[model samples]
Target: MNYLNKLERKIGKYAIPNLSLWLVVTYALGYLMMYMTPGIISYLMLEPAMVLRGQVWRLVTWVLIPPSTGNIFFYIIMIMLYYSLGTALERTWGTFRFNVYIFGGMIFTVIGAFVAYGFLSVTGGLTIGIGYYVTTYYINMAIFLAFAVCFPNMQILLWFIIPVRMKWMAYVYAALTIYDFVTTGAVGRISIAAALLNFLIFYLSTRNYQRVSPKEVHRKYVFKTQMRDAEMRHSGGVTKHKCAVCGRTEKDDPTLEFRFCSKCDGNYEYCQDHLFTHEHIKRS
Candidate 1:
């Protein structure tokens, strides 16, 4: 986690904001291609053999392949759900960490494809179209699983009617995934493991487990509600923004603009004059 923090500090500015929206747009484009020019879809798959043969575009273009195509209604619903989940994760984890998690899964999936290809070649097995087995399906599953871990008790309407908690859904997902891995071929198993490896490595290894405990979650929820009520009660008296450095608020200078510092360790804000000059706050 410390290493990740350092890396984020160095290159976090390059991380994409609203990456989920772009991903959804990419899927939409892929869907359009599927309907308009179906043959082009094959050229976009992450086929190792094709890539090695100098069709290197296949390596990156594969991400544009939509996970599934059937009922348009369900597909739209799935895209919206994933977009919400991805946005929540990006907000909670910050852009850089979310980007690492997503890109890490993609890199692993690419490696897994090549690994599977090598194994097949060595074993005198079929090697054509190996990329067909690998898709963003498991990557989407990883996003959902990560969200479940962070907000286990969050409830949503199941099939737009029955209410269900995310943890229960996660359990069902895990069970189904395990069943599929056990029943499917080597390629399928590798694809699943590769895509989900990022979740296991990032969340399980670095997350503060205590923060996810039922008691902790409940306590935080109560505290947040209390703070919200207090803020509401004092809303008329309190200023909306304040500068941590200058100790100034909009009440002090109506023309002053305040902004939160992304480089700071905590939620520190600054007024326009000191925004660039103030030293960032860091916890030891």
Candidate 2:
């Protein structure tokens, strides 16, 4: 099995459901805060210098900052677009994998912030706030990129007018990102790289792995053969349902009702006559 499959088996249960809704809610709260008390936002930025001085809440509160603060109409449209993309990704990738992708991007962004802070502190004095540059903007971009990769041919209206495929949109965005990275400063480059690192890793890992590849086909064949063999063994050689207590099966008495004991140590079935009377089995 793949590493992701192993991880899903182990910790998938802890994944948050409807994570996209929560992200939208955070953006809404940030917008409200921006309109109400803009000054408070300075305290919520992901400033590593501030964190070292004990303002550690900046690490998390930075995510609450909206990607943009201009043009309310565009902001609403952007939020709706991302909400749709995120929800679709969650449904396609499953909650746990989607959680990993998002949280991975966020974690990488945090690390990038720290790296940029260190670089600036060593070369020049801490000149400006790194938090301003290292925001969730790239993280949002990563989401769109992932959606594009997953549904490249899916069409959506561009500017609510022209219909365009996801791949075409992704290409445009990618070109813009490349241009931005080339023209921007070191901190901006680092932030962009960090934010999209998750998508990069995911794309590289899955690019060559197709759904109907030879390995997958072999796996399915083996699974089906095993299941068929088990079914044949059960049908041709053994009784379908057998009683552990009375050693009786459906063949012995067609009307016999059998049930596996829930409290039994193992696969112990009993006829209705002995089901309630037999002591529950316990394994050490």
Candidate 3:
């Protein structure tokens, strides 16, 4: 993580903000193109053989191939989900880190495709079916899994009725991915490994396993809820001027001035002391 931090300091200036938004837009456009001309996707597949044969655009153009296509409702939901998760990760990790994580995954995926190509080419001449295994499906799944790790306690209304925690769903996703890997052929396994290698490296290096435990999440939830309830009760259910950093209200410190930070992404109030010293939060 320290090494990554140093790297970020060196190249963070080149980071593209709202990168996920552009990615989502690209997916949408790709889907539109698919609908308009189904044959167009063949030209965009990640085919190293084709690239070696002079179709070099396939290397980058494959990103335009949407992961899946079926029901309109589900497609919209999938796009929105990735957009939300990607944006949240961008906000949490800062633009440079998020960019590195995403682009690193892409680079690993490309390496996986080339590795599979080499293995296949050595055994038999280049096969026509290899690129079918390489797609954006696993890459998007990695993004979703990373978000679940970072915000495990966050809940989603499954089917707009049943409340489900992100961690539980992530576990289910992991199980399904594992099952696919175990049951699939070597090509599929290699593809999956290549796709997920970035996530494995990213999480293993930076994850604070202790903080993600159920007990820690529950304790923080309870403490914050109780503090909020106490503040509400103290203010007769009309609270205002609360400090974002310490959760201190004007009632707690009558003399402490409160000010809203202009640099923070959202509306964040800070106490007089922290007003100048608190870390600025920016959402991209």
Candidate 4:
């Protein structure tokens, strides 16, 4: 376990239920099985047939399957890398967003499998979308890429030879996935689609996507500026809406700012930054 994991455990119970640790544990188990048995290439290796055969569990489980641990050194390296990524994403996105990204990939993989099943049912083409190897892997890569995009300066020791920036590494990983999709058939294609979908979701989910009137935005800025100035004087600033759920000051993000909780119908202070960015609306 990493320090972050331990800290999370000690500080609160939130991290345990998080998808990152579960994914890592699943991968560890898969890798262990693969190591103990040498000849068979099963879902542990991301085979499609096992996935399609109502091994539907693989739909979500395949994500935990580790990359081929060909050698001792490589296995250790991959394990470290995989767990590191899990911890980073868990901390960055919090439990809910991270769960959405992971489970979204699983949903995409299952949908891909069903689509593949439909094609096979009709065209009677070769078996496809057996294991969700591609989907799970790409989802992981997409999350890492998202983290890299947000924190480009983050670094890691690559092959124990050189230090590399995360952004460039993300680009390289994406290119490799594209290359695999073009070269490999079926399963790879599904993975590519799932990964691309994750990226699309992440990209469309930024403050930049907000749409609000310029007057409101200016007011927000002024409000925040005033708040800071007033804080210096130990006095309350001008009125600015604050989210009851998330303590986001609606001083900067004017657009999409929340007010008067629609559900509660009364006092509310949520900014738009907290609304779309959170899992406030439960699916009925």
Candidate 5:
């Protein structure tokens, strides 16, 4: 963990990973469905338009639909890969932001589908092939891109031995996404739109969103507290000096060290740990 994270933890704050379980469950279920028969995914699922008509399950289950279910083993491999991607996203974006990336992509694609429907209704439905034919995979890509932009030098295994920089990963994914959008075969294109939407939304919402300097964040809260305590200790009053433990008093200085009493006196000194150095006090 970094310093900022440490500080946040010290303050009893935390960033939770949001909405990742759904992706895991949805895709895993799809993988299971494929084992039973081929084209089962489509059969169990309805086209977006069909869903708009009445098959409401389409609206939700649509996300579980994988790019392609190759073989039993192949889907297993893909599930493992996508899960790795999911974990990376959770760590990079705290729960709150990651959910935004996910739902934002879903929402944008849904909007695109409705918009595409409006156009198709005017004329007729063109074969955009399977999926929404919109770039949705990129929603995921854009989030990774944001993380890469923030931490370019971060390293990851391309495939075990081939060490790669996060920046390269983002670039390579972005190229594939763009190529898929332009080319005829749309493989996981809806994901591209979703990823792009993540980028746009984050960029727009957090144009001013930059990591807070850890020092500044600490000073603002922690240092402010220390200052308040220090001020109270120095305030003008008939300051008394006596040890509640031994009643030792320095009459001349009236500033002898005496730790506060947590019991009877409620304010006399001879702290619970006299031998243990207390850094919170100022010595004459």
Candidate 6:
């Protein structure tokens, strides 16, 4: 993270702002184009074979491929969900880090496609041939997975009723992605691996694997809640006098006496136990 901070200081000025919103708009345009002219996606797919044959446009155009072929309602919902996730990530990680995550995934996906083509060419088997499998589908899914890892405690309303934590959803997503990889041919496995490689790298970079565990998250949550509750009680004036040493107040021990020290430089107050034994406060 310190290294990232130094890198950000050097090149953060060049990062694109609101990059996620632009990506969502591009996806919307892609969906619209698909709706208007069916079968147009055949030309936009990430086909390394075609790229090698001089169709270089396929490299960048493949991002226009919509992740889902559902109806308009479903498209709208998917767009909304991804837009929220992407924007939240941008806000949390800043534009530079978010740019690295998304574009790194795309670059890895392209590399994976070429690797698939090379493997198929050598084997002469050509299983699936890396046609449409290397699309932005898994890349988009990786964005959601990254979000879940970042905000594990965040809750989402499932079907507008059941509340689910982001961490649980992340687990489910990982399971489904793994299942898809195993059931499909080697091409699918390579594509999934490439698409999710960015997420894996980013997750490891955080060094927060243990922090996301259920027990650790719960313990942190409890500690934060206790501190907040104590602050609220103090702010509400429930405890008028407090011992500086033990951080307790009249509310905790009404029988204890508190007094300001005359010899101390400032208005240092202490309870009976610490009033005589504590060192006197002094201005440096």
TM-score of each: 0.73, 0.72, 0.72, 0.59, 0.57, 0.71
- In model 4, the runs with Cα more than 4 Å from the true position are 1-18, 38-57, 132-135, 207-284
Whichever of 1 and 4 has more lDDT, that candidate is 1
Root-mean-square deviation (CA) per prediction: 23.0, 20.5, 21.2, 21.5, 17.3, 14.5
Comparing 2 and 6 on lDDT, the stronger one: 2
lDDT score for residue 164 of model 6: 99
lDDT of 3 by residue, 86-167 (tens): 9999999899999988898889989898888888888885556677888888989999889998999999988789999999
The lDDT of model 2 is 0.92
Model 2 over residues 1-284: C-alpha lDDT tens digits?
29999999999999999899999999999989988998988988999998999998999999999988899999999999999999999999999999999999999999999999998988995736898887888899999999999999999998899999999999999999999999998988989999999999989887767667998999999999999999888788478788787888988999999998999999999998999999899998
Residues 91-189 of candidate 1 have per-residue lDDT tens digits of 999999999999999999999999988888898888887878889889999999999999999998999999999999999999999998999898888
Instruction: Please give the lDDT score at residue 8 for candidate 6.
Output: 88
lDDT of 4 by residue, 27-66 (tens): 6776677667754335443444665566655555555556
Superior candidate under TM-score, 1 versus 3: 1
Clashes counted in candidate 5 amount to 24
Against the hidden true structure, what lDDT does model 4 obtain?
Answer: 0.64
Clashing pairs in 1: none
Candidate 5 lDDT over residue span 1-284, tens digit each: 25434655564244335355567677667667766665765644425567666877766666666645567666665556566666677677666556656776777776666555555566665523334454324544565676777678988876567999988987897787678767743234443454477676665664553446676787688978999988877864434565544555555345455556343323446633451443334334
Model 5, CA-based lDDT = 0.59
lDDT for every model?
Answer: 0.91, 0.92, 0.89, 0.64, 0.59, 0.88
Kindly list the per-residue Cα lDDT of model 6 for residues 1-284, writing each as its tens digit: 78778988999899888888888888888888888997888888888888888999999988887788788888888888998999999999999999888999999999999888888889896634487788788988999999998899999998779999999999999999989999998888999999999999988887857878999999999999999999997789656688889988888878989999898998878999999999888888
Model 2 poorest ten-residue lDDT run? 125-134
Q: What does the lDDT come to for candidate 6?
A: 0.88
How does residue 113 of candidate 1 score in lDDT? 93
Worst 10 residues of 3 by lDDT: 122-131
